[model samples]
Target: MNNKLISIALTGLLASTSISSAFGTNISIVGRIQAEYSGINIEGFSSQTTVNDPTFFSSWGIRAFEDLGNGFRVVTMIDFGFNTNGGSIGNREVFVGISKDSLGTLKFGRTHSPFADFAGGWTIDPFVYTTLQATGSGGTMIASANGLGSGSYSAVNSVVRFTSTTFNGFSFAVLLMPGDADKLEAHLGGHLGGHGNNIGDTGGENGEWDVQFAAKYVMDFQSHKLEVFGGYSRDNVSSAQKKITAFNLKTEEVGRIGGVWSYKNFSLQGQYDFISKALGAATCSDAAALGAIGDVSTRQCNTAMNPGGDGSIWYAGGQYRLGNATLIAQGGMTDANKTDVFASRKSKSFTVGGLYHMSKRTNLFGGYQHVDVIDKNSIVDRDRNTWTVGMRHLF
Candidate 1:
């Protein structure tokens, strides 16, 4: 089936390579794959050198567009991913949507949340969220791609994605994933991530629900670009709602704001996030029952405990093309989430690397990184240094 799609897409590409007409359709296949070895070390864990793709599984996808005249078009894409080391299919991305000169762009079927855009704009990006970079293995600064612990419990599966056409250097985008009582939210990389749902949120009978809303704006200048992003997500349960007995659950809410800047060969990005903890009578059950079933249970109005927290990250990076080689350097620090306890979480990472273009379709790259992590109580003060070399090919 994948081969057939690629074959048809290629045939389409060959049939309509020109685009001077107002009405036409074209298809293309695009993707990249890489291989590398990772030397990992944790606070007290054993160090190991493992070979695999650090950023993500190798994947490919087909993208097609059809011009419908009157400044409008239809766009569709689907990607299949597979692990390089294990050679097994992983996750996937699928979308089909339309765009217009005035209506903007909208697509459905499991897509990246608008917040995912914030993942790549500055130097820390592309790699900061990569599991191969400095503290990449720790998922330290990387929020859950599936919307698990994002913004306290904010964000929804952008199963429905929308992007506004650019106007005078400004553009906007949003995502919506509505569910029963519990809402779900997702973001980043156009991946099929996550959306939070309250337990037993079936229908609206219990008076419980969840919602996630996100938006982003990009400002383009003559020499650079700036993008602003913000989002909010929440889960609420009414006092009348109960699990096994009767009671109420604390409401959950999270908010985020930040942006990215790029000019010439330099780029910078940063963001701040806060989540309010789920606190209240907790459960309607007695202390013993609560103890037996846990502080959070399924009685009259019991819900999962929400540990609201705060996280901030920033990074600066640049590339200089010196003939066939592009020199790269990046340094950044993440103020870890510590909304509840002493919350003394912090991390710093520095890296230097180079990518040598072998041709239009391939590149050779190598780099080294230094990273440190400090937590509250300083229980685990793990530090690591990595040296890696790899190659990537685009097709």
Candidate 2:
């Protein structure tokens, strides 16, 4: 069948199957489109500004719930990524699950991990603001090992996820990914390029297993909201016989604590994170091994550079509502231990933005941001500034 026909058939099947059931089912379609223009200037460097490409700029989601007898239900959500500029499909999320008011929900498929969901709540001004752009430490840390990417803490492939229903304003979620441990060894050889000859010469199949877990709690009291979350992930690689292992198995743990206070039309919020060490194989062998001669050769070769280290991050922001318009401003920074190879970078950023409610499901927004980076190691000049203006529509 043609692509269009296939899509039509699948959608029809979903509708028919859902409607034919004894339980009543409801389906809702929703999504958003955001178009933005941004200008950036790095201190000591030239400045550039341009409109953002709308690819994946606009997306849609379909969520359906079947209400079974006695408070039981089946729920499924599929979100499609699309470009606003060209209107094309991007990546997509598909999942199926069973939910019960007292028992919670259990889902199996590709979905967001607990860690990613928690970060979305803790990170101030996410998707709505322009100043905060750090990718690492924000969400799922496990996906970084594989070429496969994750948003905050989302994971693809195969997963079993569980989310508990709120009990007195408190809830929790967990996700598990089951896979072969030997995959880690495969990456060591392919990416690091070694054959298990020396400590630095180990190649493919450095057997290792990957696992991640996260838990979170939220409480709402009158005018304030509190959230506490923690996440742990490990990637362990076993060295081949006769190979020198420079680093032991690697593990990372992340924790976050935050709160939000609201009064009248204004809200204030803050969050902090503590991260443990990260480990990875070296990129380059001895300088000489690459055909360089003399003192360069004497320099350390094939040495692993693990950027992981202890670090903390925090940010605070406030928003005030005025009729159809809302104003927002926030600032945050991250600090890492000097053991990190990527120099300890500190950022101070603030954003001033206003949102205009076009309608119940649509809004127009424009914002400006200023960011300054303080580099301790002189890795690069210590400054970056960004200015952005954007609009969003929801359905």
Candidate 3:
């Protein structure tokens, strides 16, 4: 049954592409393919090795644009993500946007958040969307739950986002997500699972909204370049309106700041993420979180206890270009909210890697990461070590 449905959906997507092209819309296909050999060693578990794309680094998409004249254009992007090692195709980021030369762009549907765009995204994370990335896998950036707010790789759904035109290398982006879940949906937390068609994080069906906004400025000197960015994100739900009998679900709020400085062939980047009322899946296990070196499922803050929890994550990484190879080293820690009911779910990680640029669109990368995790229970405390070698090519 599922296979049949998937086949139908894929056919429809291809049909749409053909139909749109027939209407004089300019379309282009773009994406990348990444493959890696990964090995991991955990304190208690057996060492494991795999040839896979743990980061879902392989994807394809269609980008279409129709010139509306008068400096206006309509743009559409639909991306599909799949693991080269396994897993079926799934949606990555899908959105339609309107753009004007003088104004800006307004996007609707699932899209990247302001936090991922302006504040602390690829600019700060030298290895973003890769197996060695620091967002969810490395515990450097505090990720959101169910894509309700800003996360490194998660996209906001059912949202309206705007990006202003750059002026003097300064620009801003804003995102607004409306809650359309009812009481029943709120009880389920809107979308609890990782992926699929989810309306949006629960906003208690009350008059509440989720918002994220960020601004960035880039300054280039004769021999040095610097980029500064900051942003705030919030997911509000009325306690009185959506409170569950088992536990209190407070609002999730996040503040992010980061910057990058480059001189010659050397670059330094860092980001700090602060999260309050961190939410985690009730189904998360200590072993899973402890082993989340390159897994997004366990990338949340404090899952042992939600609501009222507060914590932060900070990352600092540097890159030095030596000929065609660039060396990378990054370290950061996640401090989960500590409480009497459970031990602090804190973890610290350091990653060292290098990328060999074979060409402008192809690179070979490898990295080693060590993580020390303190679980909610002392008995489950563990350490993780990971090594990966990968190659990626863009099309």
lDDT per residue as tens, model 3, 234-328: 76754442455333456767787888888888888888878776544311211112234324323322222333467777889888888878888
Model 1 vs. true fold: TM: 0.65
Worst 10 residues of 3 by lDDT: 1-10
- Top TM-score hit: 3
| TM-score against native, each model | 0.65, 0.68, 0.83
Best by lDDT: 3
The better-scoring model by lDDT among 1 and 3 is 3
Q: Quote the lDDT for 245 in model 1.
A: 27
How does model 2 score by TM-score? 0.68
Over the stretch 265-374, how does candidate 2's per-residue lDDT look in tens digits?
77777666555553432221221121111122111112222344455556677777787777777766656455623445454566666667776545566666555555
Evaluated at residue 224, the lDDT of candidate 3 is 92
RMSD of each: 10.6, 10.5, 7.3
Q: Return the clash pairs for model 3, or none.
A: none
What candidate 1 gets wrong by more than 4 Å, as runs, is 1-27, 101-103, 118-141, 147-158, 180-263, 266-306, 336-343
